[model samples]
Every structure is written in structure tokens, then in C-alpha cells.
Target: MVVLRTGPVAVGGVTLGNHLILAAGVLGTTGASLSRMLARGAGGVVTKSIGPEPKNGHAGPCVAVLDNGILNAMGLPNPSQDFTGELGSLGQKPVIVSIFGGTPEEFAEVAGWFKGTAAGFELNLSCPHAEGYGAAIGVDPVLVEACTRAVSTLGMPTWVKLTPNVTDITAIGKAAERGGATAIVAINTVKAMRISTALRRPVLGNRYGGLSGDAIFPVAVRCVYELFESCKIPIIGCGGVSTADKVVEMMMAGAQAVEIGSAVQRDIGIFETITNELYAKKGIEPGEIVGCAHE
Candidate 1:
């Protein structure tokens, strides 16, 4: 299959085969996994979030399955320096490297590893489970802007992933815009946890985790709608988007693209399914419906 299939998508100065991108942290741990998703019909893929150093992440029981969604606290584990080798197999593919750091300098340092190699960068400013990085630095507008600006200066299409744990997501979205971000990825998993009744303790080993799946779809839509109203940059809607209908709904809410994570866990061929379903249901392009709800 072609690595970069021509399409109508041009979000954040990046061209993709389609609007359905594989979200970070799912089947993105290696070059093979990333390429598998692309072969399965995903427009592109975001690698699992990497950092300045290798991280083993938290203890066991990192994931808890709920009726409505999945709660996970993966802690953003990655090989860090070793991640560069994984990219050799993905040459010319629209692969955006997801990165995180505790500070602006660290963020810049991590992103610099992929300079001229990655199609773009998705700053992990929104991961709720990661303490020093992720939401810890993302909740504040100042840090978001600083981290974004640091990476933006490297001359790559930078997309800041925002956390929904905050009261106002648009504030952070605007901050990314002010920092010269090419696009804003709205609503990472919602901060949440589940208590085990039989064990009488938290289900996750981390005690807290971010919730994602069908349940958070509405929350994601709301965040995208809000961010659309405030930020001029392209918006990538992420969170429980699983179906063709959800993709359209996300676009209507102002998302130029959508990321599928939990659904991919259920079915690796989901991208192909949604692509056929989307084309069948009127063959609408991504640009035509983005922010349609505003009208």
C-alpha cells in the first residue's frame, strides 16, 4: 500500500491519506505496529509518546475495562533514545511522533530527535496519568504555550494534544495557537478511576487513570466544539470516535481529523470499515463538514 495516499486532508500543514489517524499509545510501540495500522487503512499514525529518557511507567493493573469505556494509566512508557531506530522502517509515511517532557526545554530536546524525519509532532501535553509531564504541565496556559513554542521553532507541524481535565480547554487551545502551533488535538482521555468492589481498592495500580471509549465521545465533541470557537488552528478530535457516524459528528463539531484508539483495540480493521462506511454515506470530505455545527 502507498505510504501517503492523496486526500483532502491538510491539517496543521500535514497531508494525510484520510482523516482517520491512529491515536498515540495504541499499536504504536514499534515501526511494524505503526505500519500495520497504515496497511489496515489508517490515514496515518502517531507513535506512542516518548520522552527525554526511558520510562518503565507505573505498576501492574494499568488498565481496567468498564461497561462504557477503558480506564488506563500507562504512565507514557517508552524506550526514549531507542525510539529513533523504529522510524527507519516508516520512511515517507505520514507518521507524527508523539512526545512529552517535564519542561519546555525537555520537550524541545525530545522533539529534536526526530527533526526532518517525522511528518509532524504531537506534543503530549494532555496525558492525564503522567505526573511530571502530560497534564501536569498542560493545565497551565503559560506552560502549554512555552512547550509548543519550543517545538514550533524546529520548523515542523506541531499539534498540541490538550487535556480535558481542566475547566476550560479552549484556554489551553488558544495558548497553543499563540505559541504558533499548526493544529490543536482536543480532549485527551478524561481523568477518571474505577473502584474495584470485590478487591475493595482502586482498579488501576496507579490508583487513577484516564477514561476513554464510547462514554467520552460526547465530552470530546464538546471540547472540539469549544476549541473550534476559540482557536484558529486546525483541530484534531480525539477520544471515543469509533464509527463513521462518530467521525462525521466530530467533524461537525469542528475537527479536521479524528483519532481512533479504544476502538482499534476491539478491531484492528476498524479504519477500513469506517472508510467504506464514510464513503458510502454521501462521500463527504473532511473539509466540507468541519465546524458545520457553528453554522
Candidate 2:
């Protein structure tokens, strides 16, 4: 076992072995996949957003690789089974289950199903392309607060993932905090689309998709900084994080921990690589750099 000495960072009171979290909706579906990421040095894993029932997601051609980033409209697909069994098998690694629903009650019900199985819950309130869920619920502060309050009752730490599509993300972040969220994951993918020049139609099956990767890193950093200023809760930055320098940048931008999703597709070994680079180049731990930019 190549134990990474990257030090510890906490989010929503769950103490992670390190600050590198496998972003939700990435390579974290089955227990085997989760274990694989852990073995590769991910400090924790966030499962794909699972709803009350199984979701087939969008149709064909759901993902597109762009010059600057990746566009995806997966529609939050997942097996509609109780994932507690799979979560329980992951041993001591912190597993943060990401969930979504159309209403606060529904969100609570889905969270209840995973009650003793996960270290925390990340409310997938900001998936831009999912209808009747995700950004639709996340864009409204009232709904955001209601969902946060409902899920917080599950007796596990709850982190609300907010959307950058709103005029002021901090408003949503504040609402999440007000509703008892333990932490806030700032900035989900941005709403975007790509038109196929050859086909003369939208490339994504959903017609619209969320843009991720290096294209949104600056936006994510800004959201984290603003949310940290307005809310007292810890912030988990998620956007276009791909390198150790970007990780440090996010920490300086007030993110206690950072999530890398699309970047993992480009390099599965990114976790170990970033941690090693952080330690070797700066002699600084992620925990040591949290909010350093504000000082």
C-alpha cells in the first residue's frame, strides 16, 4: 500500500486523509471503481448522483470533447438501488454519496436510504442538464434551503453543491448554510452547448449540457472565494481542477478541499501526481494553504 503522506483536510466535519476528492459523477459508481480510485491515491470518493429511482440519463452522444474542455449532459444516470451495500464494502475511506430529487421530501427519502452507509451526502443540486432536478432546484434559494434542511436530518454531514448559473452563487451558498448544510461545494458545471457543424445540430443528446474542465476553473475559484466570504461553512471547490498548481490555487481561493472530475478522464493517475507535486515543489500541504490568498 502506497500511503500518501499528503496530510489531512476536513469538509463538513468529515476528516479526509487528504484534500483530493474524486468529484461526483466521475469514476465512482460501483465499489470496485471506488476502490480503484482510492488505490490510485484519491483521498475520498463522491458517488454519481443517484435519485429515488433509476435514471437512464440522456440518449446517445452525451459527451463531447472541446478544445478547452468537455461538454456533458449525462442526465444524472444511476442504478436505482439502495447503494448502502456497496458503500459499506468500501471500508474506512470516506464515501460521500451525491443525490438528487424533485423536492425536499424526495431528497430526504433518498438520503434516508443511505443513512448509515456514507460519511456524508453531497446534494447534487446543480447539474445543469437534468430536468426537474439539479439546476432547476438549485437555482432557487428557497428550494435549495428546503432540500438542505431535509437532507441534513439524515444524521450525516451534508454538503450542497451549488450551480454557477445563478446571478449570485453566494446567495445559494448562504441559503444552504442557513438550512443546515455542513459545507458547500461551490460551482457545478456551467450551462453550455455545442453545435455540430457537419450535422448542423446540437452535439449533445440533451441539446444543452454542462461545460467542465480548464474552461471553468476561474469561475469556480471566484465562486469559492465569494462563498467563503459570505458563508461560514467550509467550501469544496469543483470545476476544472487538473494539476497540483490548480489545487493550490483553489485552496488559496478559500477551498478547503478540491474535486477533479473531467480531468480524471484525461489522467486516472492525477491524484497521486498532484499530491506528489504539491509536496515536492512547494513543501506545502493543502491544509496549510486553505484561504492563503485572502491573507
Candidate 3:
């Protein structure tokens, strides 16, 4: 059996059971859904990436699946902070608020709100489909550093989620490290789109969307490995993980924890299914798969 190896994995002073983490997903968009994930045994929860203010985001048909990944153009539509405040008191599970903004100051302000409440903060530095700020911040090392530093003063673990569209993911990875990020979430969705040839338009309403799914697993793994090779910090892997086997693969690639983005919609009980499999395979504990690659 794959017994989960035990170790201390602390983020901003909160110790998680093991490295088995559920990545941020749609469930995180609402406080009710977040509470349920905790009930289902997720180590912690990352809110759906939010912007500084309420955003209408893109219209429906925002998400599409590609051969290897999923494409999403959801405009980061989120209930405003005032409406989401109840999230702070919803459950005991550590909450790592994910926020996006057009400038460093805006991100810092968002970080400021989470002080004394959220367990950590993950800056959505990369979101392929969002306009201006999403992928733009991640492609430039200087901007990445500036944005990270701006939010560093929040006195919590700040993780910069990177984009895969860059030429060298490691460059921005290291830049974030230099800017004082506590850890790195190795990748946001990759940009890809499906088009409607008959309509002479993109399949998604936004004309383009991010691609994420089983097909992107290899790409996610490679990006995680490359970031691990370049920097020494806990890495949060997200993308195309729908089973315990994929979870193990991510651990071997050096992810301290993994996120379950689009997979939440794959099956309502998928988390329990995968968690049971991990335990059945002797991976009940978190960080247990740290050295799985060498074995």
C-alpha cells in the first residue's frame, strides 16, 4: 500500500497534514463550496482568483477543453470583497486567498485586506485569458518582482502563480523568489483556443481562453521540475490532475502540494475518489511522495 509519508509542511505558520492539496477550483468561487471542500478533506482552499474590484469577467461559454488542456476566458468574475468577507469565517481549513490586480499597489491593497484572516495569499500573476494584467505581469521578471514585493508586507506566505506562456518559466520563477515570495505555484492555464469555422469566430465568447486538462499534465510536470531546478521553495502544482497517480507524478516533479482547478467539475466526488486512492496506494499523508521520483 502507498502509505503517506509524514512531515511538517507549514505555510504562514499553519501546518498541513501532508502534501496532498486540492488546487484552487470553481468550488472556491463561493464560500459555501469552499466549506464543502474542507468537509471533503482538502488540506486547504485557494479562492478562485479575484481581482481588486468586482469584475463581470467574460460571458458564459468561457471555458473550453482542448486535446491536452482546458481553455478558460472567465474574466475573473468574482463577488466583491465585501460579499466574500464571510469566507474568512467559513471553515477551519486554511484559506489562501488568490487575487489579481492591474498594478502592484492594487495587489498590495488586496493583500492588506487578508491580513489577520487568510492563511496565505497567492497572486494571480498569470492568467492567459484575462486582459492586460494577468499574463502580462508574469512575462516580465521586473514586474513579477515588483508585484511580489508589493504584497510581501502582508506578513503571510505569498505565492506567485506563474503562466506557462513564457519562454523561460524559470526566469519569472526566480524573479518572484527575489521579490520575496514565500513559495511558487508553478503555472496558471496555458493560452489556447477553439474556433468555430462556420461562424468564423472563436468558440469561446472571449475569442480566446486558457487550456487545462489531462493533456496538460506533462507540460505542468515539466514546468514544476524546471522551477524546482531553478529555485529552492515549496511549489504548488496545478493542471490536468484527476487521479492519485497524477498526484504522485506531481510530487515527484517537486510540487510541495498540488491544486485541483478544472477537475472539480469533472466529478463532484472526485476529491474523495482521488484521496481514497492516494491512501489506498499508501499516500494518505501529504509530503510522503517527496522522493517518489528517485524511487
Candidate 4:
């Protein structure tokens, strides 16, 4: 048996066995896949960012792997918060409902949909190619703060997901804190572009997309570190984390937990492998390692 040394971490009143969490991706856009991931041993799961109602999103070939990370312009395609109540019936694992809205009131409405479900809410104010409500709200500290505070009154953990494209990430990180966020998911995808020599145009149909993967590690680390020094709430470090060492690095930067985004491209078992490897090497239970590096 693999003795995993993950580490104890708490978010919104729930104790996580380990710090490893799967970031929101295409999985939860559908109910079936979301059900499968919860069964696969993921400590916590973030649903793909959803809007108040249905959104068709941008066109695909949505994801393109670059030399470093992956660029995607999925445009926050989701079934909206209407189906969120059903999430509470999924299973035992904590469910964090990721949401996007055009206004503070709209965000509150979407968040309220989880009144009887979801352990928390992740405010996705940062998606590069997502139309209208994506990166716009995140670029403004006041807007981010307003939205965070609006949903926070629900008595559930509210996390503001920040965008790295900004020159100063700490500003927004602090703003999220001021608005009473339980946590902040640092460094959402950076705006990026790729050109195809054959096509002589942008590779992604959306022209620009959010970048994620190993390429984003340095930036994500800096943002996490900055927030650690500036804010008191727990931080969920995400972006470009593919190995156990990177996971440890994020912890040192003051992240209470780490979310693996593009690493899923490696394999579904990649998370299990990394957690098992950390466990084998440290000879500690997964819960014992959560934010050890930072402490």
C-alpha cells in the first residue's frame, strides 16, 4: 500500500487529507465526468467556471500545447448554476463551484444557487479569451472585491481566482482578501498567442487564450509568494505544477493547497503518482505535508 505523505490542510471548515487538488477543467462541464473524478480519489474538485445561465463559449480546437504550457480558449463553456444543486448529491469529496458573472449581483445569484450544496465558490474573474465577463472583472481590484464580498455572505468559502496577466498581482490578491475571501487561487492563465506557419494565422481559433503548464510555474510562484506576504487567508497555488517538487515549491510560497491543471495531459494517474511518490519519499501520510514547506 502507498503511504502518502500529503499533509493536513483546511479550507472553509473542511479538512483535506492532502493538499493535492484537481483544478477546474473540462471534466465538470458534464455531470458524468464530474462524477467519475470524484470517485477517482481527488481530495477536492473545482467545477469548470459557470455563468448564471448557459453560455455557448468560443469555438475549438480550444486547447493547444506549446513548448511550455497549454493555451486554451474554451470561453467558460458551462451548463450554468442551474445544475449546481445536483452537485451536492455527488459524493463526499468537497465540491467547489466555480462561477463567472457579469456583475456583482449576478455573481451572488450564481453563488446562491449553491445555498444547500457546494463546499465553496471560486470566482473566476480571469479567463483571457472568455468574452465580456472573463478577465475584465479581475483586472479591477474594486470589482473583484465587490464580487467576493457579495458571495462571501453566504457562509461558504469564497475564493477569487486571479489573473497573472496583470503587472501587479498582489493588488488584486489583497483586494480579494479585503472583500472577505476565505482563499485565493493565484495566477490564472496569462494571455498568450501562437501562430501557425502553415496557416499563417493564430493557432487557437480565439486568437488569444489563457496559457497554463510548466511554463507558468515561475510566474505562479511569484504571485503565491507575494500573496503569502500580503494576505492572511489560505492560498491555493495553481498553474504549471507537474511534479512533486513543484508542488513543494508552491507550498514554500505559502500555498495551503496546490491544484494540478495541465498535468492531466500527462495521465489521469499522474496526480496519484505524484502523491504516492511524495508519500514514499517522505514516509509521511499525505495530510502531514500540506503546507510544510512554507511553515
Candidate 5:
């Protein structure tokens, strides 16, 4: 049996077993998958961003593997499923449902559907490639605040996921805080694209996609740092975190919790590896290192 070390870390008033969380859009579409992650030692899970209505996403050739990372124009594909029902299936594990929409009313409507079941809601105002969704709403502080306000009234902790594609991320973070968000998830995937050499055409069917993986680690840290400086709420750092060292680095950069996404795709057991490493090698609890670097 694995003797997991326990370190309590609180985000948005909800306490988690540790600081390591599963990022949105990776390995958390269903309750079963989330259960698997919980068994693997993940502190919590954030489901893939679901819209008000079902989205078919984009066509084939949506993902392109780059030298340093991966680009995907998934277009936020998701089936019309009951999000609250899925959250209930995760048992006692904390689950934050990621929701998206084109308008503030749409965002509120979707969030209302899952109000009581979720531990919290992540307002995905910052996906770069999705049309009428994601970054389109995220870049404008007015829209970000409006969307956040619409969901904040649901009586659940709300986190606004911000996009790095903007010129000033702190402005967006402040806007989210002003709208009553409990926390801000700094730095979603960066906007980028690639072309297929053989076909001499855009790689993704959508012509562009969000870049994720190791390449975005620094950018993520920067955003987290800036948000921490500007906003009073907690910050959840996510980008290309695959190792315990990266987790620590993110916390030092001022993230109360770090979300793992692309790294899990390479190895499902990464959560265990990171937690074990933090205990054995560093001899420091995960919560102990939150914002250590700033001091």
C-alpha cells in the first residue's frame, strides 16, 4: 500500500489534500477518469471545459506535435452530459467543473446547471482557439468581470481561468477579483499554430490552436507572479509541469496550487511520482513550499 503523505492546502476556501491538481482539458472528462486520478494520488481534478450546449469541436488533424510541446485546436469538444451527475460520481474527492460560454448569461446558465454538486467552478474565459468562446471573452476585462459576476452569485467558489494571449494579464486578474472570483487560474494555453511541411498547409483544421507543454512553463510562472502581485485571491498555476521541481517552482512563484495536464498524458502516474519525490527528496510538505521563493 502507498503511504501517501498528507499536506492540507486551501484554495478558494476549499481544502485539498495537497497542492497538486489535474488541469482542465486533460484526463478528467468523466467521473471514472477522475476516480482513476484520485487513486493515483491527485489532490483534486478539474473537468474539461464544458459549454452551455454540446460542441462537436473541430475536424481531424487537430493536434500537432512540436519539438518542445503540442498544439491542439480541439475547439472545446464535449458531449451534452450532466456535469453535476458526473461530479457526484467522484465520491468524496474534490472536483472543480470547468465551464465555458460565449456570453455572460450563457456562462451563468451553464454554471447554474452544476451548482450544488461541484466543489467549485472554473470559468474558462481564456481558451485561445475556440470561436465565440475562450480568449474572445477573456481578453476583455469587462467581459471577464461580467462572466465572473454572473457565476459568482451561484454560491460556489468560482475561479476565472485567464489567457496569456493578452498584453496585460494582471489587468484581467484584477478584473476577475473585482467580480467576486475566489481565485484566478493564471495562464491558459498560449495561442500558436504550425504548418505541415509535406502538405504546405496549416496543421490544425482550425488553422490555429493553443500551445501547451514544457515550453509554456516560464510564461505560466510569469503570469502567476504577476497575478499574485496584483490580485488578492489565490492563483492556480498551470502550463508544462511534469516534475516535482516544477511544482515547487510554481508555488515559489506564488501559486497556491499547481495543475498538471500535458505531463499526465506522457505518464499517468506522474502525480504519485511528484508527491513521493517532494516527500523523499525535498523533505518538505507541499503546503510548506507555497510561495517560498518570494520570501
Candidate 6:
């Protein structure tokens, strides 16, 4: 694959090859996969969310494809500390480890395991379907701050992923900032569900899942816009971001960088494609457009 360059971007204290990052859980399960994304075009890659223990994730039918997006209740399946071995060949590529846990101590312990190997840590405080974790603890401002503090204290570039399921996303963004986060990732998947008309039951095994992809792009932009107004920290925008136009729009809404997930399922070369288009249409650096809409 030809290396597509759109100039480097610095977010959450780390320099990226470009502004396009592979969101957590999209081909992020293995070190080889994460490295592959970077090799293909992503400026950075976030490993799938890891917890305190190994998990099998949700049962069958955990993912349901939609016309506009994807709904999944994978339950945060991960190998925990055992996954560390896969990082051996990743080299110095910008690999951000995505982690989650039930408490501050748990979150800190999980981050501690890979502090030496990862370029940074993206706290997965926004997984909506997982029980006793993710949105379960993420919705509260107090816990969000505590969890962020627990991991931020580790001295790594800490980026906190926020849930859009909340009443006020800026509140959580502020909490993450108050906890000393290096940056804040806005707008995780929206909480949603689908009933199988033919099967006469819920499509997802968990009866609920997080909705991601084009459907949530507007919501993600709104959240980023709000965070940019309310917080002083850099914001990494996620949710429904796919095209180069969308990336530009997101940055205009206040995101310094953008993460793409579900869109990759359709085209694995999305990062390179987007970067090419981005530079083709807009010759200037991405930073110049950050929050341009606000002006």
C-alpha cells in the first residue's frame, strides 16, 4: 500500500501520521490488525476495549447491519493482559490502547498493564451495552472524572471516550477535562435497538446495542461542537464519520481529529481514500479548520 500523507497531526500529546484514526473495536482485536490499519493509512489505531478480565462478549447475533449504520452489543470482548504479547511487532506506530473497567482502581490497573507498550490510552468509558461497565458507570459526571483521573495519573497521554447517551455530553467532556485528560473523544455510538420483524424478537442478543456509522454523524458533530464550546481540551470526534467531507465538517465543528469505524467495514482502504480526498480538495493543513464553524 502506498503511504498516503496529509501532514501530521498532534492530538492528546501524540503526533499522528494524519488526522484519520481507526476507532476502537474496528479490526482492533489483534496487534497485527492494528498495525495493518496504520500501515494501510490510519494516522493512529486504537485497540479494542480491554477490561480487567477476558470476555466472550455477547452471544450470537451480536451485530446487526443496517441501511445507515451498524448496531452491536459485542459486550467488550477482549483478552485482557494476555493481549500484551501481540504488541511485540507493532514497533513505534501510534497505537492507543482502549481500556474499560468497573471502578477507578480497575481502570488504573488495566492502563498500568500496557503503559510501557502503548503510545497512549483511550479510556472506553462509553461502551453502551456492557453491563456494570461502560455507560453503566460512564453516565455519571463524578464517576467519569474519577475514572479519568485514575488513568490520567498514570502519566500517559489519556484520551477519554464519552457516551452520547447522556442528557448533556458537554458535562461529561468537562468532567474528563477536569480529571486531567490529554484529550476528549466525543460521541460514542448512540444507544439503540432493532426488532426482527420476521423472527418476532429483538435482532441483537442483548436486546439493545450501540448504533454507529452515518446515522450518528450529526449527533457526533453536535457533541463535538458543544464540547469545543465548553471545554479547553482537544476533542477527537467519533461516530458516523466516513467521507473526507465529513472529516472536514467534523473538524469545523471542533474536532482536532476524527476516528472512523463502521465505515471501514465497507471499505478497508477508507483512511487512505479519505486522506487523498482531504488533501485534494483542501490543500491547507487540517488544524486550520479546527472549530472554523465557530468562527
lDDT of each: 0.90, 0.87, 0.77, 0.79, 0.86, 0.91
Count of clashes in candidate 2: 0
Question: How well is each residue in 1-295 modelled by candidate 6, as lDDT tens digits?
Answer: 1122357789998889888999999999898899889988999999999999999999979999999999999999999999888888997889999999999999999999998889999999899999999999889999999999999998999999999998998889899999999999987889999998899999999999999999999999999999999999999999999998888888899998999999999999999888777764337656668898999
Residue range 1-295, candidate 3, lDDT tens digits: 3545444467534555444455654677777777787778676778887767888888878876655556778878876576457575664567778888888999988878767777778889888877777897789999999999999876788888999999999999999999889889877888888888898888899887777888788889999988888887778888888887887788888887788767776677777777676653433565556546645
* Per-model TM values vs. the true structure: 0.96, 0.95, 0.91, 0.91, 0.94, 0.97
Give the per-residue lDDT of model 5 (tens digit) for 27-121: 87888898889789888889999888888899968888777888999999986455556777666568888999999999989888887778889
Clashes of each: 0, 0, 20, 14, 1, 1
Once superposed on the true structure, which residue ranges of model 4 sit more than 4 Å away at CA? 1-8, 85-88, 280-295
Model 2: CA > 4 A from native: 1-5, 280-282, 285-288
RMSD after Cα superposition, model 2: 2.8
Report the candidate with higher lDDT, 3 versus 4: 4
Residue-level error in angstroms, candidate 2, position 98: 0.3
Worst 10 residues of 5 by lDDT: 1-10
List candidate 1 segments past 4 Å from native. 1-8, 280-282
- Which model is ahead, 4 or 6, in terms of TM-score? 6
Residue 66 miss distance in model 4 (angstroms): 2.2
Give the better candidate number (3 or 6) by lDDT.
Answer: 6
lDDT tens string, model 2, 1-295? 1122356667786878688899998887888898899888888899989898988899979999998899999998988565666876787678888999999998998898887777889999999998899999999999999999999976789999999999999899999999999999977999999898999999998999999999999999999999878999899999999988888788888998888898898898998888777654335444556786887
**C-alpha lDDT of candidate 6 relative to the true structure:** 0.91
TM-score of model 4 vs. true structure:
0.91
Give the lowest summed-lDDT range of ten residues in model 2.
1-10
- Residues 66-149 of candidate 1: C-alpha lDDT, one tens digit per residue: 888899999998999799999998888999999999999999999999998899999999899888889999999999999999
Deviation of model 4 at 244, angstroms: 1.2
